[model samples]
Target: MTSPDEPHDVSSGVSSGAPATGAHGLGPHVVGTRVVVRRLVPGETGPTGGPAFTDVLGVAETWWPDLVVRREDGTAVTVPHALIVSGKPVPPRASRLQHVPGGEVQRRVRGLWPGETAALGDWLLQVSPPHEGRVRRRASSVLAYGSPDRPLGEALAAIQDWYAARDRRPELCVAVGSAEETALRAEGWTEPADFAGHAVAVQVGSVARLRRALGASPHTAATGTVATEHGPVAGAAPDVERVRVSVTASGDRIATGLADLRGDWACVHDVRTDAAYRRTGLARRIVAGLLDEVAERGVTTVVLHVLTTNDPALALYAGLGFEEHHTATYLGPPR
Candidate 1:
């Protein structure tokens, strides 16, 4: 679900060429989403009549009343409204996870948290108690992979001991509905902690999309694209090293995008543009450059966490085909 402010662009219902629009109209939101349709009952032969299900999994492209659909196997079938009896969109497919049981993806995101981690069975204790003013929940939370492989009570005891040693408190940074969150609650560690709120989204598209968006960027000339590990970024820590990929369409480093690569996924950290470069499509070019640079490493999925209130960032990402996967909020341990 999108934030109250960020309404998704999916069609609510679709209208295809007659037969005629259904009483409720086929949900346009159904377009782009998978759906199953049952054509008018077999008043005739060959499964055409009598409430039969066309369990065909395909993306609805248009509902000109003639619902055009694209299938996974690169096949397209147009379902005319006349043939429709009933249909509805199904849940979106998840080939990625940054939510509950986000599993491997969540594990990979550990790189972005900037902390020392200790392997405690299947979990990792992020030891970022207090260094400077960065005392917060993320740096001092347990990343639960599977189960600890240790007893629950023992795990809690060990966590408390470790945090006590660091003069900090133990906390879990698991996805809201994840088993780990539930596990922590069962142990009587149920104080709801708040970290800067964030939500993760998934987008499935080819490098072609990236190339197109990049091409449209204001300073997207071939020279605009820059690929390097040490590219200059705005507001970056002077001593912090990053694998920066950016674009300089207006010269003098106007736009940049940075990523933290982990195995197959790249956590896009910052995609920025100079004030004068705003609305000029430089940011898109930067993202394109960033993704194109990382694609060489077989990075297929790009993930990012954005503040729920960042409306502009949310819109920019949505236009790039990203869809909400899940959200995570930091929850502190019991006092």
Candidate 2:
């Protein structure tokens, strides 16, 4: 049975170009995700005079003998699995925080790295000591966000000139799939082959959730010690609170991480687990310790960055309830 609340004719429903099953197919995997399902409506006729089919759009609540969906309006729709002819999981709706200005996010994340920064209107250029004859993207890329208060060509030229004068290859870091990245591409900027798989995923979540994942109450008292430091951006005003956490066993450091608090926001970075201790839960301890320290300081939100290709790190953060807020990739000079 299709929910009468949101049923449309099959003629305008299923896409003719694609298979009845969605790109990822329809099955148990789609439960708990927003999905659209098309099912036949007996005794009703569609616009084409054929048997009527109705489409249900909502979060898939259950997928077994029947598919249950909860619509945005708080209504639940149950459709028998035998009647579903087409369905697919769709991307989730944007969270309220997703609408925050990209530039602000760039500042919050990239600002955690040590660097000398120069501003170009709304854009920020940062430079740090070179490593292995190359600069880490976060340490030396132009953070391409809002308008540069100049023509696109002029901004590009300035970025090039600035880096060239510094004897460094120019790079522009932009939110992947953003208009800014697309615009730069049209101007010939390309992702360097060497950086092919280096896209970074910026993730955010609640501190309480991470604490829960640590097998403790969300409001557990802070434990361990945290050392405070100043903001990494040279000449910038110090952040409200910056702290580092380390996990040691037998007087040897096995893992460490840092968090910087800006008002109510905190960003976690520089997390590392000794290669020998990988998968030992030390990383989670480091994060949990950091969360404990920051939570006492009134920080409720936490953010972190993970390499898209690092399956372990991705899984670690996801398991702690972090969701990808955006992805960033560096664009190199025109080919």
Q: After superposition, how far is residue 116 of candidate 2 from its true place, in Å?
A: 2.8
Q: Which stretches of candidate 2 lie above 4 Å from their native place?
A: 1-95, 130-134, 212-236
Predicted candidate 1 versus true structure: per-residue lDDT over 1-335, tens digit per residue: 11211122211123443333666356554554566666643444455444554545555655665776655553557777777767777664554333434645556565545556787888888765343345644446777657886898888888888878877666665666777778777766664434334433423334444445334333244446554574322332233234676666545776666765545566665577767656555555566666766676666666666655555565456445455665555545566
Query: In order, what lDDT does every prediction score?
Result: 0.56, 0.67
Clashes of each: 27, 0
CA shift of 34, model 2, Å? 12
Model 2 residue-pair collision total: 0
Residue runs of model 1 more than 4 Å from their true location after superposition: 1-101, 111-114, 128-140, 186-242, 247-254, 274-279
User: Which digits, one per residue and each the tens of the lDDT, describe model 2 over residues 1-335?
Assistant: 10000010101011223333334367655554578888888789989999899988766655555677766554668887667778887775565566766668768766655657788888888776753354567667889887787899998899888888877777888888888899999998988877765788877876765565454423222332333333344443466457877766555665677787766778887677767766555666667778888888888778876677665566556544466788888888777
Which 10-residue window of candidate 2 scores lowest in summed lDDT?
1-10
Provide the TM-score for each candidate, comma-separated.
0.57, 0.64
